[model samples]
Target: MKVRATAKRVAFGLCVFCLLVYLVFPFGWALVSSFKTNAELFATPARFWPAHPTLEHYRHVLANDDFLRAALNSVFVACSVTLVSLAIGALSAFALGRYRFRGRSLVLYVVLSMTLFPQIAVLGALFQLVNALGLYNRLPALTLTYLVFTLPFTVWVLTGFLEAVPIEIEEAAIMDGASPLQLFAKIMLPLAAPGMVTTGLLSFIAAWNELLFALSFMQTPDKRTVTYAILSFSATTSSAFEVPWGQMMAASVLVTTPLVVLALIFQRRIIAGLTAGAVKG
Candidate 1:
């Protein structure tokens, strides 16, 4: 039995290691490439580490005004989407979780089903709406479009978490003359903090990385997201023939590092939030 257990542990460890390598390889390669000079990058045999590392690519990217502006644009759009999703999702989740209403199950199913549609499925309809509202080429257009995807997901996840909250607490609050809004503000929001952080961070990352909607809605050069900024390297340069792989990699690393940091900081909360919804006491 001891021999069998040891073999099982070893097999599990190997499987975990393989999964880690698969997930980390692309980001690791991007990080490695960010430090290398253009000459060393495409050299024969393709060395993993640069012989002489330099920070020129990072410096160039930072110095570019359009890049900085695009980063700001992305930040604005993502934060708006996250904050709106959370506020609206929390209220909807509270209602659906705590209140019994007609077609409640159907409502939950509809919200869940919204996630099933690919972004492309809604892009055309959204485009016509944006143009009709005269929001074309504006930052708000991106924020509005992103909410369609993020809000439903937020509502769905938070509903499960809110459902897991103890009903007695809410009842006690009501007995003490706490209004529904007061109970939600004072009692439920705090308990849902972990779930909020999880969903908010996920929503932010989605908005930050989204290129299709960004490309479709925003026409102005200054209104693009950071991911689009990476692509714009070719367009802004004096020579169209020149490819700035090193700089582009640096930008990718810059864009991706914050998300990594956020995940690391909130990984425990994310785990707790996700698992908290899976089980009900």
Candidate 2:
């Protein structure tokens, strides 16, 4: 019995280790491959590590004007979307979490259901609306469209956070002459920080990596986002199309760096947000 238990533990540990390697290996290879030259990449028998690693690919990506513009556009659109979604979602979450009114549950249900709708389902309508508003080929269009997905997610996650706050806290704030807006701004908002951080991080990542909307809405090269810019990195010379694997890998590594840093910085908050109100004592 003791031997069997030990064997099971060893097997479980090995499985977990393998899983970690499987998940991380691709990114690891990309990071290493980004430094290799085109010749090194195509060498016989293939090399796991570069013989002479160089920063040329990274430099090439940075020196490109269009890529830089796209990077800025991505940051602008993503940040704008996150801010707008958080503001709208926070107010809606507070009302739904704290108040009782006619059709409140139904409203919450509707908002939650919006998240379940596939992006492709509403793609056509969204394009029409953007064109009608004359926002096509603009960063604001991306910001506006991203709200369809981010806002609902933020509201759902934040409602859970707001509900976890003890009613007594709000009652005490009211007793101290705090109005509804003051209570939310001064009290509940601070308490819901973890949920807000988690939601904001997720929203930013989603917007940053979104390719379809960016592609469809912004046709101009200068207005495209990082995801779209990566696609354009495929080189076309003299009727021969060549994919710049090294440069693409470099861009991928750079693009992924910010998200990894954010996740690491907010790792604890993300866990707290996810587990909020899970086990009530």
Candidate 3:
């Protein structure tokens, strides 16, 4: 029995190690390649490690005015989307989760159905709408378009968190002569902080990484997002072989690392927020 238990432990450890390697290898390779030179990146043997690591790719990508501007645009749009999504979603979720209302089920289903639609399906309609509104090629366009998807998700996730809050608390506030807005502002929002953080972070990442909406809505160079800037690095050359792999990898790392760090930092809150609504207290 002792021998069998030891073998099981060893096998479990090996399986976990393999899973970690599979999941982490791609990002690890990208990070390593970010440090490599053009010649080293596409060496004859396709080396895993750079012979001479350098920061040239980072410098070049940072020096590009287009990349810099796009980074700023992405930051603005992502932050806007997060703030707006949270504000509106919190209100919607609270109403849906807490109050009795007409068409509540229908409204929730409609919101859920919106998430079911593919981005491509709405592309044409969104294009015409944005053009009609004179929002084409603008950063605010992304802020609005992104809400189509992000808002639904934020509401859905946050509904659970809000629902998990003990109803007795809300009842107590009500009995204490708290107005509806005061009750929500002073009581409910604070309780849902974990869910809010998770949803906001997810919304920010979605807006930051959004490509299709950005491509369609933003035509002007100044309003383009980071994803477009990454594409620009590869689009500089005609031939596939001439594409700047080093810079592309470097830019990818730059774009991905920060979000990954945030997710890791708030991983506990993310887990808690996601599952908070599953069971009532």
List model 2 lDDT by residue over 113-159, tens digit each: 99999889999999999999999998899999999999999999999
Clashes of each: 0, 0, 0
Candidate 1's residue-wise lDDT over 88-131, tens digit each? 99999999989999999999999999989999999999999999
- Between candidates 2 and 3, which one is better according to TM-score? 2
The C-alpha lDDT values of all candidates are 0.93, 0.92, 0.91
**lDDT tens digits, residue span 1-281, model 3:** 99999999999999999999999999999999999988888688888888899999999989989998999999999999999999999999999888878998888889889999999999999889899999998888899999999999999888778878888899999999999999889999999999998999999999999999988887777888999889877776558668898888999999999999999999999888888978765
Provide the RMSD of all predictions against the true structure, rounded to 1 decimal.
1.0, 1.5, 2.0
Q: Which residue runs of candidate 1 sit more than 4 Å off their true CA positions?
A: none
- Candidate topping lDDT: 1
lDDT of 1 at 141: 95
Which segments of model 3 are wrong by more than 4 Å? 1-15, 237-241
- Model 1: which residue pairs collide? none
